[model samples]
Target: MLIYNMWPMWVIVVAVFLYLSIKSYKERNAKDVIILMTVVIIFSFLTVRSVNWLYGWNIF
Candidate 1:
């Protein structure tokens, strides 16, 4: 239910990631690109887990 309710956030996150990724890659910096991906993955994981915990559900 929370996931459904927060669809906008998911979309925003994806969009930001794509935009940043492209821009970062254009600079040809391997380290920056890798760090960006790692941060996004960790951020998404924490967001879903935190939402689930706060709402007291197992939808995630």
Candidate 2:
């Protein structure tokens, strides 16, 4: 149930990030792609952390 809450947001974020990454790649916007990927990685990691906390899983 907790994962249910986190998963949707994660999916949306990843989807949008992927879309942007592809778009940037096609446009040859290296800087944009790099920034977008960085943001995606950071957000994904935070999402994982939040999920672990919610599920009482210590991932240290």
Candidate 3:
């Protein structure tokens, strides 16, 4: 599966967002959650681009 090789990166991205969202929830920080999500989105985009480049997927 194409996803098999890319699972690790996706897992790490999801894990980071999960951790931040939980922490923000516990602390009741709306701004932090928003910022965290924005950062995570950018990180995910970069990761996908890097993965595409690495694997010559041409998806981007």
Candidate 4:
């Protein structure tokens, strides 16, 4: 038996982050871009931590 992980969720999150970042940059919304980037970073960190936990790795 093969186990499938939540790869789709990660893809969606990354895609949305990139889209928003590019949109903000094109519109010259520096503040929004910063906020969006911060959110993306936080989510990325959480994703890594969750994956590590799921794989029985001690990240903390």
TM-score, candidate number 2: 0.71
How should the candidates be ordered by TM-score, best one leading? 2, 4, 3, 1
- For each candidate in turn, give its C-alpha RMSD to the true structure in angstroms: 4.7, 3.4, 5.3, 4.3
Residue-level lDDT for 31 in candidate 2: 97
Show how many residue pairs clash in every candidate, following the order shown. 0, 0, 0, 0
For model 3, the superposed segments whose C-alpha errors exceed 4 Å read 1-14
User: Quick one: RMSD of model 1?
Assistant: 4.7
Overall local distance difference test of candidate 1: 0.72
Model 2 lDDT tens row, 1-60: 565467558868977997999899999999999999988887787777777777788884
- Candidate 4 segments whose C-alpha is farther than 4 A from its true place: 1-11, 57-60
On TM-score, the candidate that comes out on top is 2
Clashing pairs in 3: none
Flag clash pairs in model 1.
none
lDDT at residue 48 of model 2 (Cα atoms)? 76
lDDT of candidate 4? 0.76
All candidates: TM-score: 0.56, 0.71, 0.63, 0.69
Candidate 3 all-Cα RMSD: 5.3
In order, the Cα lDDT scores of the candidates are 0.72, 0.81, 0.76, 0.76
Q: lDDT tens string, model 1, 1-60?
A: 455456458657856886787789999988888877876786677667766776677977
